[model samples]
Structures are given as C-alpha cells and as structure tokens.
Target: MKRIAIVLAAMLVTAAVPVGAVTAQQSSAESSAYAGTHVSFDASENAVTNYTVDGETVLQSVSTSSQANAGIGLDIALSAVTDIDASALSLGTTTETSATVQADSGATLNAHDNPKGTLVIAAGDESQYVTANLSGESKAEQVDDSRVVVENDNRTGTFIVVGDGEVTVNEEGNVSADLAEDSRLVFRSYDGERTAEDERSEELIANGSAAAEVYVMQENGSTVADTVTYDEQTTVETTSDAKDNVTMTIDRSVHEGTIVMTTVSEEALAATDNLSVTVDGEAAVEAESYSELQSAANGGDNSAYLVQETSADAESNVYVAVNHFSEREVSMTNDDSSTTDSTTADDETTSSSTNAPGFGIGVSVVALAGAALFARRRA
Candidate 1:
C-alpha cells in the first residue's frame, strides 16, 4: 500500500475533520520579486488552494488523494509569523526567492526562483503525492511521456515529472500521477513571450551547458537526474586528435540505462559526415531516424546512437542515444572528400535546416535521473 506523508513547518494541530473534507483554514505567501505572484495553502487539508502569477490565477487548486495518511511535520528552526492551534501550516520567514512546506510523512512543496525571474514549484515525497488542477480556460498538453505543457490565458508553463510512475493529463486539463518512492514533480512558469519549446529545452536551460550529461533512471521509481557541468562527479574531455577531427570522451559511473549526447553547433551541423560513436570500446549502430534510435535504446541494445543531417541552419542540434554508461567516445571528422560530396549534394537537394534537434520528442524511454549536461566548446 502507498502512504502519503504531509510535512508542514512549525505548526500545531488540533482540529480534525472527516476524510476528504476541505480544510477551513488557509495560509498565503507572496513572492518578493514578482509583486503579484502568490501561493495559498490549506494546512489542515494538505492542499494548495490557489497559486497565482503576476496577479493572474494559473492553478485553481492542488490536493492529494483521499487515500493519503495525512500527517504534518514542522521545521522548528525558522521563526513563525502566524500561529493557530491544531493547524499544520507555517509561514517561516517567507522570502521573494524561497518558500517551503513540509509534512510529517516526508512530503514537501517548495517554491523558489529558478532563473531569477521565473517561479518554480517543486513538490516531492518518498511517500505522498498531489494532483494539480489548472485554472479557468487553461489547457494542458502532453509534450511527451514525462512532460506536460500548461497554457493559461496569456502565460505558459511546463510540468517536469520525474519518477517511474505514469503521468496523465486529462481532457479537463487536470494533471495527476501515481508517483513511486523518491518521485518528484516540478512546475516552472514562463511569463510573457518565453514559451516552452519542448521537454529538453527546459532541462537544458535548467542544467545549462556541460561537456556531458547523464540521466539515470533507477528501478525503485526514483531518478538521479543532474547535469555534469564540470569534472566533479562525471569527467568529460574533448580533444582534436587529427586535423579537422574532434573527439570527446566521457567518464562516469557505469549505470544500466540510456545515455544521450546532444550538440548544437554550426560546425557539427556542417560536418555531419563520418560521425562515429563507441560505448564500452564497442562500435555503436546508427539508427536511421530519431524514433528508430529511441526504440533501439529502450530495447536494451547497449550500442545504439543516431546521427543525421536534416538542414543547413546556422546552429543545428544533434542527439546520440546509447544504452548503458561508462567511458564512451564520439569522433567526428570533416573529411575533404565528404565535404565535396555534401557540397555537390546540397546543389541537388535543396533542404533547409529549420528543425531543431528533437530533444525529448520520444527520445528516451526511461526516466531521467539527473540534470541535462552540454559539452564545452574548444576555442
């Protein structure tokens, strides 16, 4: 049986109601930088009643299922501004950048500034879960299996669900999931004209650029998704071994899942000839399309990757997906003969490079463990 734990910070509890009843009490917190954005919580009911951004309501309400064994955990370290008997909610020194609410069952809902201007809501629990209800006229679209896009009156946001559970977006625009232990649900708001392109765009922007990125999906319904920006835990090294040739080697802990490599460089786009990838010292098989590559990766084939040229854009994104992890190397050479072939072919085939790398477009079948990492360029 799955149990739900709700942890609240610094609050006492006394009032008890029947199961599934909306709590009579509520608490609100405001974002300091974004003047009109705020979130309200129903402490007793263990639900977020309202969440607004820039004075516009984006979320109507968010509540856990009735099957949850609700309990509140309070953080006693921070100073509390308001106090109520039998209430399980706390507003501890709420700042413009951060706010937190936890329950005794280890469930937590946190709001913070992710990219300085954007508001991010992160909810996670080893035992509890919650479902979100979109506000008026808002619609939800599933970008992929793990991501959903929410469009409101004039703003857009994304939900990044990381776990072994299934995420569903109903016709009514409601979002729910059956999260496994160590699961996480992250919501980030994009105000004005900043729209979410796809799932990978959010991950890429959040994790930034690194030499290599590893996403590990464990078997226990938990994920270890993070970006390797430097050679701290994962080591990534790039070298030009030969003239007009480049090679990158990534070293990290060996894990039993898929490894994806993405590059958005004009040089890579122009020199898409003689691309080769190897994993665990074995040559990888190139898939004809992104879908085929995804199928091969999920099929447990440890030696599968994709390399293709769709157009002639200034910057093109390329993805290479492989099963398993360890020391892997990717080599690309700008052969003069291949260049001539490309030039002659370009004269015959008038194809423009407008499609970006299909990041998160049914790319990987497993859950992401860590942040998205990009390779550093050699100047």
Candidate 2:
C-alpha cells in the first residue's frame, strides 16, 4: 500500500513539472560570507576533501580514498552569488557526521518557492559497501524535489527547509529509500534559525531503549497528519524463546513520519501466537485503510500521534507490527492564504499560521519487519 501511494505521488509530480523548467543548478549568494564556499567530510581529512561550487574548485582532493572515513568525511562549497534569482541550493553528506549550508541577508537558495530547488542526501555511490554517514541543513525558499537514499549502513541524515515556503518532498525527482536500523531521515520547514545546535527539533528513537522517553519535534507546525498506537499480546512457550521476540513501536511524529524499533534474539523462533489490537481503547479490528487512524484523531491536534504495541506468544517470539500510517495533508492555497487555523483536542483549541506558497505533494514509506510497512505523504 505504501509503495502504491509513492508511485502515485511520483506520477503526480512528473505531470506537474512543466517541460523545460529551470532546474536548481546555480550556486550564488550575494553575501560572500554566507555563500557556501567549501565543504569537508571531517576535520582530520580536510586536505584530501574534494569540493566544487558553480564549476569552481574550492577544495582539491590530494588522494582518492574510499575508506569509510576517508577524505573530508562530509562537506560542500558554493561560489559567491552575483544573482540570487539564478541560484539553487542543495545540502547532503558524503562522509561528514553533520553539515550546514546557509543563505544570509534574506537570500534563499532557491528563488521564491520553486520546486526545482533541490536538497539531496544519498549514498555517494550505488555500491552496497559505499555507505556514507551524512546529515545536512540549508536555507531554501522551499524543499520539495530533495531526497535521501540509503542502502547498507544505517546512517542518520536530516534536511531542513527554512522560510515561508514549506517542504514538499513529493515534488518531481523526490524518491524514498528503505531505511536500516538506527537510521533517521528528516525534512523540516521552519521560520526561525534552527541552525543552532542547541535548537535541534527532530529525532528518532527505538522502543525499550534509553532514548525511548524522547519526543521528536518539528518547528513551525506539525507535519504528522495522523498516528496509530496499539498493543499486541501473545504468549511464549518458553522463557528462552522470548529472546527471539521482536517488538516494534511505531512513532508517526518525526519528519520522515515513522520511527520503528525492532528487537533481536539469540534463540530461534519458538512459537507463534494469535494477536488482537485495541486502538485508543476500542475493540481489536483490522483497519481497512489508514483513514481509520485519521478518524481516530477526532479533528483535534492530529499533528503528533502515538501507537504502542506489546506482544507475547504461547511459546514466546510474538511479533507485533503496524499495517499502515496516513500522510499529513498539506493545505496549499493562493499567495493570499492565511495561517489562522485551529485544532481542538480534549476540548482545547490550538491555533497556528502557515502563510506559504502553493503546496507540494510527496510520500514517505517506512518499513517494520518482514516487508510490512506504513506510508506518509505531504498533502
């Protein structure tokens, strides 16, 4: 179901982008200091880092190394911008633990809210062993055509979209990749300077872990359109078999929209047990579609939703997982659109504003175990 939705979103984006549209290829910043001029993967390998901005070599690599930590771990550089209107911006990682790219003096990486402005964080190459750990940030008019593609090593990566324009990941060229353990991909849109380390707002957590108490946040407004929380209980045949049991806690609050936790075991499968769910304290039933989760919101503040699952089998090894998650619907209006909106939860009303350009559409797929997954798309 998640794949189907993503395919449909891709189709919509392919149709929306006009032919011969200008892609984000420029790297110009009026304020020379704000313009990204150089990038490094790590401080130790700075001399060997290779980077370019607008066809100019800001840094030259002295050695060609592919070691996991070879060269400057992760970095980028941009040439001085003579014209902001002709420039485009992208932020990603090759080997750096984290990086940032900014446009100062009210200059946006992309002109207006053009979807063509892209931000990408993907495997530097297609080789399975060529895993790269990268996290990046950039100031753009909007973030829609960007993507984060990973294959082997589960490295945490995040992308931030700043300004009145929101992020639409489903725009043309946006793609989703299956995430590995401990891997997090975030796409955020904010009005403030989130570049400060102390002001980070996104995170990924596992169930039963030390960080389980943490709650991931998104600045500006909540993008989580829906959420699901349930419990799965099964019996175990033997105490040892419990070691193989896998329990996943589904968090629909993060930017990619889903956080999964899986348990490993030293023992083999002992037995399987029947399972049932009680959504929001209701009777257990199969959800025909994710819309049911949205209905659970009750028209309140549905931005952040939580679902918990616990399982036990007759002989242990009881596995519980969610079947689906709904994407947040984006309300895009003309330039005159106002941010005067409210959501009521527990008889309490919360108001927010989003004076954005038109909306961008996209979808993100999150996997649990055995290929089971959930889907989230920006409305």
Candidate 3:
C-alpha cells in the first residue's frame, strides 16, 4: 500500500471553487526609455475574463481540465517600432491579485502574443508533467518564503503548478509559473541559479548556454532542505553471491529538462535471454530498458525499481531494486532470500537558506535494498 504523507503546507491552499469571470487591466505613463511603442492587446478566458491594450487581445482564457483554473485574469499589451522596454509593470485581477514586473529592457516587446496565466494541478496516482510558459524579460522572487513573485516586463503570459507536482522553468529571463505549496520548481538558466545562491553550492551542470535553478517548497509554502542531484551513477551486484550472476548499473541523468533513467546489465545474453525490469512499480522489459521519470519526486517517479536477469543455462537468477527521493532524511529496507545490493549518492548537498536564491529543481534519494526472492508472479 502507498502511504500519503500528511503535509501541513499542502493543506493551506483553498481548494478551487466555482466562480464567475474576473478581469483587470493597467496602463503605464509614457516613458522615454521605451520610445516609439504603443501598448495594445485583448485577453479573455472561460466565462469572458479579458485584458486589452490598444484594441488587441493578449491574454485569453487558459484551457485546462483542472478545476483550480477558475479565477481572475490580467492582461497587458504594448507596441514598439524599433524596440520596447519598461522598468516596471503591474496589473491586478478581480480576485485582488496584483502581479508586478520590472525589467532592464524590452519588457513590453511581445505583450500581445505572449502566454500568461495560472494553472493549478492536484496531485494524483499516475505520472504527469506540466510547464510554466512566461514570455519577455521577467524575474521571480521568493517573498516571505510563502509564494513566488513572477513578473514579466514584455508580454502577457500565464503560469501555474498544481498540488505536489513539479514545474520546470527552461528559459532564462522569462518568469516561471507560480507553484503552490507542496511542489517543486526546476530552473534551467545559470543566471537564475546565480540569483538563487544554491545552498549546496554544487557546481552548475554545464548545458552549453542553458541555465537552471531549482525550488522545492513544503506544504506551508516554506522552502525545504533538499538536494538536487544529477548524472548520478550506481551499481548493484545482483548475482555475485550466487556463484554466477549478472551485474546491473543504474545511471540517472537529465535531458531536455526530464529525468532519463537507463539501466544496463553485465550479463552478455543471446537474443533469447530473458530480462525484466520495473521502475516505480511499473514493469519494464529486455536487457536494456530506458524510461523517463519526472524531474521532481513529489510525483510517483521517485520510488522503487526492480530488475531481474536469467541466463540461458538457468543456473541462477539475480534481482536488484532501488528506491529514490530528494530529501536529506532517508530510510531503506528489503527482505529477500537472494541477490546482492548496495546504494550510495555521489551528489553534493547545499545549505537550505531563504536569504540566498537557493532555487534549482533536483531529485531526491529514497530507500533501496538488494535481496534475491523467487520471481513472484503478480496475480
């Protein structure tokens, strides 16, 4: 049986309730910095929430299946001949939400076409993923460690995170969607990570020009003490004790902002050999199995994995399993008659402080053990 952690932070957000359409718009005083630009846009959503600048719709009704989508919307639009810029932009929704943005330049360059809004997803039993798309130049600051303040200087866009899911901010300078408590937010820009002052002080993973920053918040919306590890490599000795058995290696890495889990076996088997693997309790097949898990463990990806390999001779069978998570605290247990196993994380740890940016999305390590059991059949 799966145990649901009773997180206090997860309880604070008011569950979404049915509500009527709400909208708000704001205009700025003419600025010498942004010359030859006129602000114009039209933005509306379900039930008719709208924001317009100079007769153009920028933010529109965001379409999603989550009930948390019902709320107020704000839209701002601006135009320019050569370029557009702004120092500060602020708007509010009827829900009394006042989102503000301040940028060094080009803040309103694409206000009419940029995507903006909030989307909330509740935690669930299956694997899922979501992205927060914010356009223009924007910055997100964690104010009072309760909620993230994301503002864009240029375009109108929507952003959100639901329940205990993870949100990845892949681009630099654009704001990521706001995540409620009990969620994880991953950043890919080196600039954002610099502002975050990663607590573990782990060297930034080089992604050519790509940058990243990670955030993991508790149910109360406060930052938690967690480490983001990447490219972690571990090996499990499954048949060493059986006088003859195969070896398994588990390599964890990130690609295009997603967790790529690849498993390789030492036993060189013919095409007829039988090998089976299970990730997070889901069955996988063959000598090599590659699967992608969520970047954050708040979802189901951070769980146990089991691998079994049998040779053509059928002399012995080997089994291996690992449980993964992203917290400092860890627990492990296993009860099987056969198999050899060991697990350790080479990832570094940073101090968790609210004073520094300390924002980056990373995964956790959970319980894991090695034992050999008769291949139990699932009835």
Candidate 4:
C-alpha cells in the first residue's frame, strides 16, 4: 500500500508541473519606454496596467475580458483622465513607441506613440467582437454605426472609435460592439492644447491623417460628407450626389498631395473602360501607380492612373490615383442614361406586337405613294 501511494503521488506531481509552467508563462509582463512615456503589458490579463507620461499616470489600467462565444471586453482606467478600458485574449509585442495585444478570437489592441500617447484598438477578424466600458468624467456619443466620440469633462483629450460594426454608446459613455475586422477605435491626447469642439462635427467617414475612409452614396441625398485634412496643408470636402448616376465631388481647391479614389460599379461605366476622373471638366491623364500619381501632382502635372480592378461582385472595384484636384468629379459617365437606354432597347426588342421597323417602312411607302399621285394629277 505504501509503494502504491508513492507512485500515485509521483504521477500527480508530474501532472501539476506543466500547469504551473503555463500559469507562469501566461502571467509574464513586458514593459517599454520612450520619450518620457512608459507602458507595461500584463500577459495574464492581456492588458496594459500602466500608461504614464512624464511620470504622471495618464492611464491607470486597461484590461480585457471575454465570455463564451463573445468577442472581447475592454475596461480602461485613466488617472486625471477618463475611465476607458479594453480587454483582449493575449499580450503581443511591447515596443518603446507602441504595444500590441490580441485576443484568440481576433480582436487586437494597439497603443501607438506611447510617448505621444495615442491608443488605437482594432478588430482582427472583421467580426464585431470588442466591447468597451466608459466611466469617470468621460462621455461617449455615438455618431454613427461606425463612429463614437468620447470626451472627458476636462477636455484634455478625445477618443474616436470607428469600425464597420454597430457601435453603441449609452448615456453613461460605455461603448460596446461586435466590430467587424479592421474596424478601429482611436484615442488622441491633446494635453489640454485642443478642445473636443475643435474636432469636426461632420460624420467622420475617414480621417486621412489617421486611416482610410469608405463612403457609400445612396439614391437619397442622405449620403456621407466629410472634411478630410491631409499633411496639415490641405483640407478637402467630400460629397456625393443622390442620383442613380452617383457623382463624388471633392473640393480640392486647397489640396496638395496625391489622392487615391476607389470605386465599384454594378455595371461597366460609360465612356471609360476602367474608371473616370475629370478635373475642371477635362479628362486627367492616367498614371501607373499611386507613387507615380504623387510625383506627377507634386511636379505640377495633373495625372491619374487605374491601379487595380477586381471582378468579384459581377463587377470589380477600380482604384485610381490622382496627383491634382480641382473642381474634380469622380463618377460613371451617363450611368443612369445608359441603364435606361439598355433597358428600353431590351423591351423594344422583346415586344412582338410593336413591329416598329415594319410600321416605319409602311408609313414611308404611304407617304411616297401620296406624293406621286399628287404629282401625276398636277401634270
């Protein structure tokens, strides 16, 4: 009996060793610092427990959690800041300027410019899989399905959460969503230099300085319009028309840089095989790539190029690069008229009772006979 007990004890101890090792591995933490800023990542919690600037605690703790079949949960605590937190599944790399964390379910958290103090959280799997809790003096307002604006009472900074998912911010400023992959939430620290009001009021379709923006114009005038500021040198207003033939207009009077425009059509656009772009009513020349477009635009030539087209949804999206912008309109040429004409032609061809061609010939023959009879009578 004693020998049997010893053998069982040995088996139990061996089984316990691997569990303890995994626990230690999951509990490990990583730290990095840059430009008077410091960040610490806790692997066990999959969170940032400390985010400090100039030795002042700007963030207390940012943690993540998950439930069965759910994406991820995020909870943040700010020191002399707002209460916003995020939770993920695991901790990734930690660098001086940034730290990354990811969830097994594909949610990702990225803190960039830790020295400058910016945090951006994104969905990895294109699923609306991230939920955030907002507390303290912070107030969150939902701008649209893809945008949420969080502001604190002191107005020291602003957090903009954008994704292709349904974003909800209650009166308490808590944010929750099952965000699609690549959807992002960004936090920008103004350090009391700028107020939340300084941010544009329009629905932010995209911020050129931060990331790409996608806008879809419907038949109704209710389309997305935004002011995009690039490189701090150019501000452009983007708007679209409500017609079947959608027209995207960019006010590039004060623009400077290469602008990329991508479009998808249900059918082939009129007059242009790939994509159409016009500046001041003149067709702009096409370049080979975005780099070429940028070079041409910066070198005083208006140029454009079709980069790619994919025929996935019966038609492909066309990517165009342009170097200059001036009274610019990006659209399908006569899209509505072409569709109408094609439909009309199809209907005419299928109508057996109309006999349009025969009717035309009969009318012509009658007119000629009447003219000949009148001439003979006169003679």
Model 4 over residues 1-379: C-alpha lDDT tens digits? 4554455455545544544465555545223222323333333444444444434444444443332344323442211112223344465665433556676555666665332255566655445334444435555666565555655443334445454545556434455554455655555443344433235311222343222222232212133222222122333334333222334455444455345443333432322453455654566676665446546556346655443443223333333334555545555333345435433222110101223244444465555556555555655
For residues 1-379, write the lDDT of model 3, one tens digit per residue.
0112222122212122111211111122321111111222222221111332223332321111121331212231110111111122222221111122221211111121111122222222222222232333455543322233444343322232223332333344222232333232222222112233222111222211112111211212221211222222222211111211222323333222222221122222111133333443444322222221222221333432223332213212222223342211111112131253332111111222222122311111111111111111211
Query: Cα lDDT for residue 186, model 4?
Result: 54
Which 10 successive residues of model 1 have the least lDDT summed? Answer: 1-10
How close is every model to the real structure, measured as TM-score?
0.39, 0.20, 0.18, 0.39
Model 1 per-residue lDDT tens digits across residues 121-198: 223435444467788888888766556778888667776655444355854558764445555555666554432233
User: Where does model 3 exceed 4 Å of error?
Assistant: 1-173, 188-226, 229-287, 291-379
Best by lDDT: 1
Report how far residue 84 has shifted in candidate 3, in Å: 20
lDDT of 2 at 261: 19
Candidate 2 structure lDDT: 0.23
C-alpha displacement of 285 in model 3, angstroms?
Answer: 8.4
Q: Quick one: ranking by lDDT, best first?
A: 1, 4, 3, 2
Task: Note the Cα lDDT for every prediction shown.
Answer: 0.44, 0.23, 0.24, 0.43
Candidate with the larger TM-score of 3 and 4:
4
Model 3 per-residue lDDT at 358: 29
lDDT of 2 by residue, 1-379 (tens): 7666667566655645633342322222221212221222211221212222222222221111122222222231111111111112223222111133321111111111101111222222211001112122221222232223211122222342221111222222222222222222233222223333212122221111111111111212321111111111111111111222222233343222221211211122222222333323333333333344333333322322223222312222111222223322211111221232333111111223323234332221112211232234322
